[model samples]
Target: MTTLLNVTLTPDQRDLLEVIAAPWLARGEWPLWANVQHHFDMRGEDADAIFHSLPRVGTQTPFGAGYGFTLPMRAPVDGKDRVRLTVAASLVVPKVRPVGEQFVQALQHMIHLYTSRPMHFDQVPTIILRSEELEEALPDLPVWFFDVLPDLLSNEPTIITGGVHTSRRAWEREVTRSVLQYRRVQSVEGYIEKTCEIVVAAAAQYGPAIAVAATVAAEPERSPYIDAGLLAELETAAATNRWKVHKLIALCQGLNDAYIAENPYACAAMIRSILDHIPPVFGHTDFKHVAAQHVFSMKRNDKTHAQRLAAFKDIADDVMHRPIGHTTPRISMDDLPEPIRLNAILNEVVIVMPKSAPPTT
Candidate 1:
């Protein structure tokens, strides 16, 4: 399974990237080649030589428009999905590697090089693995990390594989520290090195679990728990709403998790939440107006989209908008209707954004 992630940065981090990327950006280099020879300090490069030396799908450099570049490591695009890295204003990495463990290893490598502080998060600053794609890939995400942290950091004075370890405490500390540093301008000591240590440690400790999660995520039994079709729809929605990656990620995570857990009430709650969230992103307040205006570009009728959303809203209202004193009974799995229609509605919102085109001064 290929995963695309957009790393949201703090203003200071953005400034740092601007400074590092200034010379190239000034030269009209949108999708600059990743300087393979010197990965960390990318000043000038011999593009041809770097491309030849680096690990990739082929000799051909990835064709794209961006200010950053792909990492120089060899990519695994066979059997496993390929892991492609594009570093720019946003450190966008699409895991295309064939093997899930390989992808996690690549993720660890790029993540280490990217930052010590947990810059990649949802809305929060902690090193929260905030991608629905990731959740699908790693169902027991937090547990998996804790399980794998010890062996990865085995060289340290205190460490254990498949057992409780201090690395868990260390990992938590790094997240908290990163959150503070991200929110504030203050710098912490050994932030980058410590981050690398923590990440690598976790990766090593949970190597087996990571591989299993990746495999399960990549190839799940035919069940509503893992919907490949819905995954595709969500991915399309994600790419369209790239600018609002954080919000999209949060929403996607909520929707996917609810479905996987088979909780109709939670799914309904997500549907309503998505309905409320869509308006502001598209520069509209009334969802009915949005539907009447034919906001989605997927060639569906406004009336149809409007009605489906209305139905979704009604279904969600039981859990989402019940009165404070009203005792609403919990919805049972057997009583729950799968939210395929709501998923389509949310995806349609992504499709129609560019077409709607909010007014400019």
Candidate 2:
């Protein structure tokens, strides 16, 4: 017996699917029927519903009003029944290729449409709650920040005017209308949450695809650990080179954020920036010559410099070098916990810089 997996769809998703499904669907036949079974071994039993509901090719209807379709589609798994897949129409089409890329494209387009629609007052709170949940659930996932959160936040209209406008009524009707319509609050706590849930739900449907996207899109997170001692040393180091203090401070901030986000590449880049600046500050001028000397040594007074310098150089090299078309070598978060230690060591190197030369006449 063939297994059947059920896929769910939101009302809006079902409607949008109907529009895209028109080309592949025919009144007398489903063009995609053989393709889906051949490729995915899946079948949509209700193909007629889609074709029967489509308006003529050239006709137009109010956006989202005329199309209709059913969802909870079925697919087989492991030659026996398994979990239901909540697929959209985008996922339904046969020609959609290369392992779910087409599905994401379709989903993103629908997201554009969903967010563009005017939201009701009652739905705002739910969206905001959902947004917070998604943020908390996927703190390091860039998709939540870049795609989902922005969509939710932008969905709520800040202004109340110009939509389906109506004039104030005459005395009999005006006096009795609800005063609530005139009152509006600035809270967006709800709108964002609901939009977050929607995006997350879609991500869950296309888990592998979204996960890959998240990895590509993610940035470094902020580190929780701050070193007072290191910070003080950096401040003092910056005193002589006050003009360059901003760059140092920015590096520290970037490092902290990267460490927390577990972004190894970003963390390494921050280290490399400080390393590249070191030789120039003290007039060594040649990075290739002095890079190893400073990185390999601890100040004579700092006993742990040998171990720390060795460790820091090992990590720095992994992140800084790429032979060709390859990823950075480092991956683990073990070294990220104490970036301040490395920063402090770099500050020591900076302290030796000769003050700026007197201006030449």
Candidate 3:
């Protein structure tokens, strides 16, 4: 009397899984079986199917895809975040004589093939989403923003014409909106410097034109938050329009997209940095078992920040034109009806920025 969990796969995911199952699914062997509940369209029984069909697209990249509508995945691990005890226990259902790390490695490899990449395991980690905390993460940010972050991580096609610059900047803004609200590193100076480095390196590596535009916009320094030297490097990289991700990754090698994905704004980065700096153990998040791979792709602010600003503004403007749904929009900090609006107004949209104390002298 064991309960089986049924998981659904998208057409693409199903096709991908078929490729991985090939090894185990050789001739003369019994068909591979999955733990699917014996029922037709029972609500929770189709959890796997529903998760795959989510409106937002998911990436099958070696590095795990973040953002987009993700189904909650939980498992009990040894440290801070553990896969669920029950789910982890399910792996033994097949009753292998020696079910251990080797078995686990096999399963992971199978997953990698299905994903179509030899992504570094260290880089790609299974992230569990916290339904409650994620709600808070969306605070003034729109939910749709999450769906687009994965797109930014992918390499754009070679055929698109020159306007990739405009689109690339737009993507940066959307990415910024999604992560700027999350936790990040403590120092803003260290953050922007690293971002510009990544963008420039991306450009020099023959990244798309939009990618180059993102690097160009991030190429110079005006505000104190950025590093001038990194800006110079980006400018030099710009001349050739070629970048190397590995080389540039060294700049802000450690920053998380949630922590350093956007321009350095004392106000925006305030709460996010606090979150990024905290050890995950003490932090409040739905992802109990998170791997060490943190950070997202991002851009830095410079004097040319004007174009960067407008790109993001256009995105925000576009969002304004869409239909509002069951949930009230987030962009309107003021729409926060009396109770919520009261505090926002009092603080002047500064969620974490503290007001300066008068006359400290």
lDDT by candidate, in order shown: 0.39, 0.36, 0.25
Over 159-249, each residue of candidate 3 has an lDDT whose tens digit, in order, gives 0112112342232111112222212322322222333333334344442212111211233211112222333443454344222223222
- Per-residue C-alpha lDDT of model 2 across residues 1-361, encoded as one tens digit per residue: 0001122343433443444344333321222433322222234333223322221111011111111122222111111211111122223434322112322332233333334556687663211123334334445544313222232122212211112112221111111111122133112212222222333343345332121111212332232332434555556766666335567667767776776567777877776675565555545554444534543323331224324444566667766675656653546766642443454455455455435332234
Per-model TM against the reference: 0.32, 0.29, 0.16
Residue 237, candidate 3: alpha-carbon lDDT: 41
- Candidate 1 has what TM-score? 0.32
After the best TM-score superposition of candidate 3, give how far the Cα of residue 195 lies from its true spot, in angstroms: 34
Where model 3 places Cα greater than 4 Å from the true spot, the runs are 1-22, 25-327, 330-361
Q: Which candidate is the best by TM-score?
A: 1
lDDT of 1 by residue, 1-361 (tens): 1112222333433333344344332332322323222332354432232332222111122221111223322111111222222221123122211122332332443244236554555675534332333434556444443333332333221111122333433321122222232222112112222323333344445331111112212432112322334445555655654334456557767776876677777766766676776774456786665666644543432345456676656667777667667664767654443333454555555555545544454
Sort every candidate by TM-score, greatest first.
Answer: 1, 2, 3
TM-score of 2: 0.29
Q: RMSD to the native, candidate 2?
A: 23.0
Candidate 2 residue spans exceeding 4 A from truth: 1-229, 236-243, 286-330, 335-341, 347-361
**All predictions: root-mean-square deviation over Cα?**
21.1, 23.0, 25.9
Tell me model 1's lDDT, rounded to 2 decimals: 0.39
Clashes of 2: 19
